[model samples]
Target: MFSRTFARSLTHTRPSASLSRACLFYTTEAAPATPQLLVRIKADVKDAMRSRDKERLAVVKGILSDLTYLEKSPQAPAQVTDSVIQILVQKSIKRRQESVQSFQSAGRADQAAQELKEIEMLKVYLPQAMTEQEIEDEVRRVVKEQGATGPKDLGKVMKELGSLDPAKAPKKTVSELVKKVLGSL
Candidate 1:
């Protein structure tokens, strides 16, 4: 009788409320949704095609292709998240930058210019980079909070800063800044 009454109450409750309660109790949460960044990038591919913007189309397609490859590989995460996409974009930019340098060295000005354009497009997706002053401020804050003193504490300060701003503070820049701040102590 008690079981019947509880079940009846659940059924009689407002549909939305009952559904939420059922979901919460069952512990069968829905799978994570696709990250919005991936959706936007996919949409841009179509827009580029429609507008006949070959350069934009090429850049977005390259990004999507990289994503597909990663998805199939053993190293792929269970679900592709925005951070994964951002990291991919960063790597793509780095590769293109190197290509630009190579092209410039070879006196291929036109090829180098093309690569620079693609780099600008890719940079749109990444979060704004931290300025030098901002990096210095962050390093100092982390150092103070962690009570780090001298070069010995560099690793501790870096670890905390990484957690705090993984996307904004470029690792190499942050590492250099950390060392500078630590040296002062």
Candidate 2:
């Protein structure tokens, strides 16, 4: 009778280290919800409107306008996922980057600066890009997993990596890295 009570007391008094660690790290509150890119862009547009910031307002509205165009197109998806949004945001930034280079070459530094600012605003919607080191490590792991031994297997290696979360890796950079790794193989 007393043994049962003592055992219960002992259990209450000392949780296993792993259990205690889990309890320490675990959260009761739900993780913050990640809103879609369109939602965030619309919110930013509203904030820009309220602040009378014509520049940011224009950039965000431009993104929204592009989405509307996509929606009206015959090829629009039935549902918009974050990956699609990420791709759209990246494309927009790439276009601006091209414009920035053009403007700089045309001796229009002011316009180039504006484009850079717009790119920054658009970048807010993109997933944080993985570093080169991280990409290299991932490529190595994938090559080993796929038993890719030569440059001829580059496509196979790339396909495996592509199956990962799309927003995390920049495709151009990843492709170049794959070529480098496979060449060394």
Q: Residue 94 CA error for candidate 1 (Å)? A: 1.0
| lDDT of model number 1 | 0.89
Name the TM-score of candidate 2: 0.75
The residue-by-residue lDDT of candidate 2 on 1-185, one tens digit each, is 57998989887886679997888887788864544766777788899999999998898888778877887899996767778778778889989999999999999999999999999888888888889899999999999999999999998999889876667787888999999999998
Indicate the residue-level lDDT of 105 in model 2: 99
lDDT of each: 0.89, 0.86
Clashing pairs in 2: none
Question: After superposing candidate 1, which stretches have Cα over 4 Å from the reference?
Answer: 1-29
lDDT for position 60 in model 1: 97
TM-score of each: 0.79, 0.75
Residues 73-173, candidate 1, lDDT per residue (tens digit)? 99998888888898889889999999999999999999999999999999988888779998899888889999998999988887788675555667888
Candidate 1 backbone collisions, by pair: none
